[model samples]
Target chain A: DQQVKQNSPSLSVQEGRISILNCDYTNSMFDYFLWYKKYPAEGPTFLISISSIKDKNEDGRFTVFLNKSAKHLSLHIVPSQPGDSAVYFCAAYPNYGGVTNKLIFGTGTLLAVQP
Target chain B: AAGVIQSPRHLIKEKRETATLKCYPIPRHDTVYWYQQGPGQDPQFLISFYEKMQSDKGSIPDRFSAQQFSDYHSELNMSSLELGDSALYFCASSSLGGGRSDTQYFGPGTRLTVL
Candidate 1:
């Protein structure tokens, strides 16, 4: 089963604008969420994350908001740059077990920032 | 200051053969995990090893096994490989054992092709 889902397979936004990528999870046990950005032929790099205790977390140009009631989370990038164009993956971890933190990832959304 | 390192960047194996992929976690990290990414799909967790012990196994088949050594390096072994095993295998390391709060650093990935 796909516990984490990124409904949008691809997204496009203009440079200097805001880009919002959405993710939804069906599992209620998950308490931590993360977003990773990956470039072609390279490993995925961590971008930002939000804990279950907090509704939102911000890191410079990137902000992640979580809504536990809806089981939804989003990553917002302000002033999107061409360099930000890549595949974005949303992952979640369950709180109880040792393996929960291993990360269950979404299908990924390809983002394209137009110059 | 090195990130996760994976060996045999590319491997081509025939059906019924075995393939071994290796990973070296960054210095001082205690947790290591393996993931497989297929075409047009998200990274799927295979297994996790912590402190030279098996922590968790995902949806992978029994043919897949992993081992962790005293030096914190890990190896993934696939026995009797099938054609469906063609994908990119990634190794990641984290400082913490559980929860999504800790970020994982990944290697460039090993592209495995089973003929």
Candidate 2:
């Protein structure tokens, strides 16, 4: 069963605009959520993350909003640059306490910023 | 500024051969996770380790095995490799004691092609 899903496969936006990517998950056991950006032939790079305790987290130009009741999360990149074009994956894991373990990932969304 | 490091960025192997993929976690990070991504597919969790011990398991095949060493480096060993094993393997690390404990930093993936 696919616990995490990113319904949108691709998105296009003009440079300097705001790009929003969404993700949904079925597993309520997950307490930590993160977004990763991946380029062709490269591994995913860490973006922003939000714990279930909070509704939003921001880092630089990237912001992630989580809605626990909806089981949905989104990554927003403002002033999107052409270099921001890449595939974005949403991942999560249950952190009961001490150490965290495996991560379940969504099907990823490809965002293209047109200059 | 250091990130996770993966060895043998590209590997070509024949069916029935064996392949070993290595991952070195970032300094002071205590967790390592392995994931596989096939063509047109989202990344699937494989396995993970914490402080040199097996922490969790995922969809890893019986032909595959992995371990973490004292130095915090991990290896995924695939025996009797099959063509279906061809994919991009990624290693990610996270620190449980840091402020960004929930975020995982990924390395440049290793591309394995089996003929």
Candidate 3:
């Protein structure tokens, strides 16, 4: 069972525009959510993250919004640049039992930025 | 800014053989996690260690085992590997010190092909 789901397999946006990638989850026990950007033959790079306690978190051009009631989250990149084109993955962290838990990841969404 | 390092970026193994993958976490980071990503699929959690002790377990097969050493590096040992085991294995690390403790940074990943 996929606890985290990225419904969109791919997304395209023109440069200097906004790009939005969505993710959904079935588990409420997840207390932390993160977004990672990956390129071909490279590892996923840490982007932005939001804790369950907060509804949103932002870092530079990247912003992540979380809706706990809906069990959904979205990563938004404003004025998207061509360099931002890559595979974006949404991961959920279960923070129960006072110890670190494994991350559950979504299938990922390929983001393409057109120059 | 040293990142996580994974050795033997690519490996080809025959069925029924054994393979060992290694991971070197960032300095001062005490936790490590392992994940496997099969073709066209999301990453699946394998196992994790905190401060040289096994802290959590996931969907890792019985044929696989892993451990962390005193220096904070980790290894995943796979025995009697099967063809289905071909995948991209990633190692991620995070610190409990401060500032987004739950966030994880991933390595370039080891691509394992079982023939």
Candidate 4:
């Protein structure tokens, strides 16, 4: 069972536009959510995260909005740049079973920021 | 101050052979985790360790096992690998026992090819 899901396999957006990536989770036990970006042949880099207690978290040009009631979260990048083109993954930290903050990840969304 | 470091960036193994991947977590970090990513897929949770103890193992086959020592190093062993085992294996680490507030840093990943 895939606890986390990213339905959109790929997204294309023009530079200077806002790019939004969405994720949904079936497990209500998850309390911490994070986004990671991956480039070819590299490990995923931490992007942004939000706790269930908060609705939104922003860092400079990137923002993460969490809707706890909907079990959904999204990452928004304003004025997208070509450097932003990469595979983005949404992951969740499930506290169930005392798992030591292990993450459950979605299939990932490939974002292509066209210049 | 090197983040997570994984050895043997790429490996090719024949079916039924044993494969071992090594990881050196960040200095002073006490938690280590393993994940697997298939082609065009998001990373999948495998297992996690804290202070040399197995904390969690998520949906991994019995053939897969892990060991952590000295709080800064870990290894994942796959015995009698199958074709399906071919994928990019990543190692991640976090400080402070990887609690809700700690963020994980991932290694560049070890690409395994099972023939």
Clash list (residue pairs), candidate 1? none
**Cα lDDT tens digits for candidate 3, A18-92:** 999999999888888999999988889999988999999999999999999999999999989999999999998
For candidate 3, give fnat to 2 decimals.
0.66
* TM (chain A) per model: 0.96, 0.95, 0.97, 0.96
Overall lDDT per candidate, in order of appearance: 0.91, 0.90, 0.92, 0.91
C-alpha displacement of B86 in model 4, angstroms?
0.5
DockQ of the candidate models in sequence: 0.71, 0.60, 0.59, 0.72
Best by lDDT: 3
Q: Taking the tens digit of each residue's C-alpha lDDT, what string does model 4 give over B15-102? A: 9999999999988889999999998777888989988988777768999889998756999999999999999999999887877756
Candidate 2 regions with alpha-carbon error over 4 angstroms: A95-99, B97-101
Instruction: List TM-scores for all candidates, in order.
Output: 0.96, 0.94, 0.96, 0.95
Q: Per-residue lDDT of A75-105 in model 2, one digit per residue for the tens? A: 9999999999999999888655655567788
Q: Which regions in candidate 3 have their CA more than 4 angstroms from the true location?
A: B97-101
Displacement of residue B23 (Cα, Å) in model 2 is 0.9
Point out where model 1 deviates above 4 Å. Answer: A97-99
Reproduced native contacts, each prediction:
0.75, 0.68, 0.66, 0.75
i-RMS, each model, one decimal = 1.7, 3.0, 2.9, 1.5
lDDT (C-alpha) at residue A36 in model 4: 96
Between which residue pairs do clashes occur in model 2?
none
